[model samples]
Target: MSQTATILVIDDEPQIRKFLRISLSSQGYKVLEAATAGEGLSQAALNKPDLVVLDLGLPDMDGQQALAELREWSQVPVLVLSVRAGEADKVLALDGGANDYVTKPFGIQEFLARLRALLRQAPAGEAAPALVQVGQLRIDLALRRVSLGDAEVALTRKEYAVLAQLARHPGRVITQQQLLKDVWGPSHVDDSHYLRIVVAHLRQKLADEPAAPRYIVTEAGVGYRLMG
Candidate 1:
C-alpha cells in the first residue's frame, strides 16, 4: 500500500501555489501550502512531511534564514525554488542545507524529475548496500572499495566520499556545497577549491577526461553529476 507522499510547498505567490498544488496532486502527491516562511516552518514541524518544496522568496521571513533554522532541527530534504538564479544564491542555499536548487520559470518536467530525485534518497540510518554498480564502475560501500572492470582504482577517503555520493544518486547532480559539507563537514561548504581538487583526483584515478568525461561531469557553475 503506497500512500502518496506529502509535499510542503512554501511560496508566497498565490498563483504559484495553485499551480504547484494542481501539478503535484495530478501525480497523486498530497500538497500542503504555506504563504509565509513562518507558517511553512510551523507546518513542517507539525506535519513532518516526507519532503519540502521551498521558495526562497517569502514575505514574513527571509527564506534563507528559514532554511538555516529548519536545518538546525530537521533533516528533511529541501528543494529550493527561487527567481534568483545567480551562482552565489545557489551556493548559499545549498550550503545553508538545501538538498537542491531550481531557478524560477522552470519547466515542469525538469522540476518533477528533480523532485523525484530528491525523494529517492534512502532514509537516515538504514544500512546502505555493500555492493552497488553504476555502469562499469563497482563500489563496495562497506569496504570502501572502488573498481572498474577487474582492476581496483585507488582513491583517498575524500575522493571515495565524492564518488559514493554521486553513485547514490546516479545521473543526478549533487550540488558542490552539499558534497563539500557532507564529505568535509559544514565549515568547508565554501571551499570550492578543495572539492575541485578531490574531484580532479577521483577523475584521474577513474581515467575520466574533463573535456568528454565519462564518469563525472561538471555542471558549469552549479555543481557535479555522475554520468550514466
Candidate 2:
C-alpha cells in the first residue's frame, strides 16, 4: 500500500520539481507536479494525493497561504520546501498548517528519512492513541486537554500537537525540524522559534522548574528530548 501512495510535488523551480519527481518515483511513489500554488491546489483537490511536497515561494501564491487554504479543506500531509532559514518563517509555516519543512540544499537521505517518518505518522486506518502521560502531565488527545498534578494546563493547538508528538515518543531526541514539522505542520520546520516558544510554554506548564526542566530537556543546537 505504501508503494502505491501518490505524492504531489509543487514548486516553481523546474529543477526541484524534476529532482523530487524522479527521486520519489524511484522510491516507488507515484509523483505529480505543479509549477504554481494555484495549480497545486487544483491538483490537490482533484487528485487528492496521499502527500504533498510544497515549496513556500510560488508564483501564484505564497506557500504559507497555500498551506492555509489546503488545511481548510483537506487533512493531506504537507511537507514544506523552502530556502528561508529563519526561525520565524518555520514557526509561521508550522503554525499555519505544514506537516514538515525542509531547507534548501538538504541532504537527500535526510529528506527521504523525514518524509518516511511523516508518512508513518499520518492519520490513517486505525484511530490514533488518545491518552498520553509524561511525568505529572496527563494529555487527553480526544478531549484536547492537559493536566499537571492537580492543576489544569492550557496549551495552544500547536502546543498540544508538539507535546503529543513528544509524549508519543518518550525518551527520544526529536529533532527541532521534526518537532516543528510535526506540530506546526510541514511549512514551519525551519522556524525553530515556534518550537522554542512552544517548548518553553510546555515546560512552564509541566516541568518542576521551567529554567531547568526535568521532563523536557534541550540538547543545545541538536533538538529536544522528553525524559521519561
Candidate 3:
C-alpha cells in the first residue's frame, strides 16, 4: 500500500522532515510536509493524507491541539512522533487522538513498521468518499468544510463535529448519549444540555428550524436525526 499511500509529516525541524521525506519516499509513499502546526493542519485538510506523522512540539501551536482539531472532521490514522518520552505525554497524545506514538531518535525500521500497521487498518480498496451531499447542504468531511448550495457555511469545531456525525448517517436517529460521547467525550455522555446547545447552534447555522425542520429533526426526548 505504500506505493499509493500519502503521508503527511508535521514537524518544525527541517532536518526531521527531510529525513522522513527521504525514508517515506524510499518506501514509495507520497509525503507532504508542514513546518508548523497551523501549516500541518492546512496540509492535512487540503491533502487528506492516508496517515499523519505528528510531532508534539510545534512553533505556532501544540501538536496535541492540532490533533484535537483534526479529529473534529477526520478519522485518518495519526502517529505522534515527539521527543517527549514521558509516560504522561504519551498518554495525553494517545487519548487526544493519536493512533500511535514514537519518541524521537527512534529507529527508522520500527517507525516504518508502525506506519504500515496503521495504514493496514484503514479501509482497503480506495480511500473512503470525502464528500457527502444532502439536498442543498454539502459537506467535505476531509477538509472540515461545509456549504449550503452556493455559499460556504462557517462552523465552529464543535458545530462541525456534530454536523459531521449527523451527516454521516442521514435519516437515522443518533442517540443523544452517542453524540455527547463522540463530540464532547465520555465524561460528557450524561450532559444532554451540551449536546442540545450544540445542535441548536448547528441548526441555526444551517438555516434549519426546529418547528419546521428541513435538515435536522428532533426526536422528542430521544435524539436528533439528519433528514437527507
Best by lDDT: 3
Number of clashes recorded per candidate = 0, 11, 0
- Where model 3 places Cα greater than 4 Å from the true spot, the runs are 123-161, 183-205, 219-222
Find the 10 residues in a row with the least total lDDT in model 1. Answer: 122-131
lDDT of each: 0.84, 0.80, 0.88
Evaluated against the true structure, the overall lDDT of model 2 is 0.80
Prediction 1 global C-alpha lDDT: 0.84
Better of 1 and 3 by TM-score: 3
TM-score of 3: 0.78
lDDT of 1 at 208: 87
Cα lDDT of model 3 by residue, 124-211, tens digit: 5443335678789998865678999999999998988888888777789999999998889999999999888988898888889899
> Candidate 1's residue-wise lDDT over 157-200, tens digit each?
78888988887666789999999999899999999999999998
> Model 2 over residues 1-228: C-alpha lDDT tens digits?
386788999999999988998898899999999999888887886777888998999998889988886774467789998998899999999998888899998888898888888888788753333456677777664344689887888888777778767765678888999988766779987999878888878776675565667677788898987676
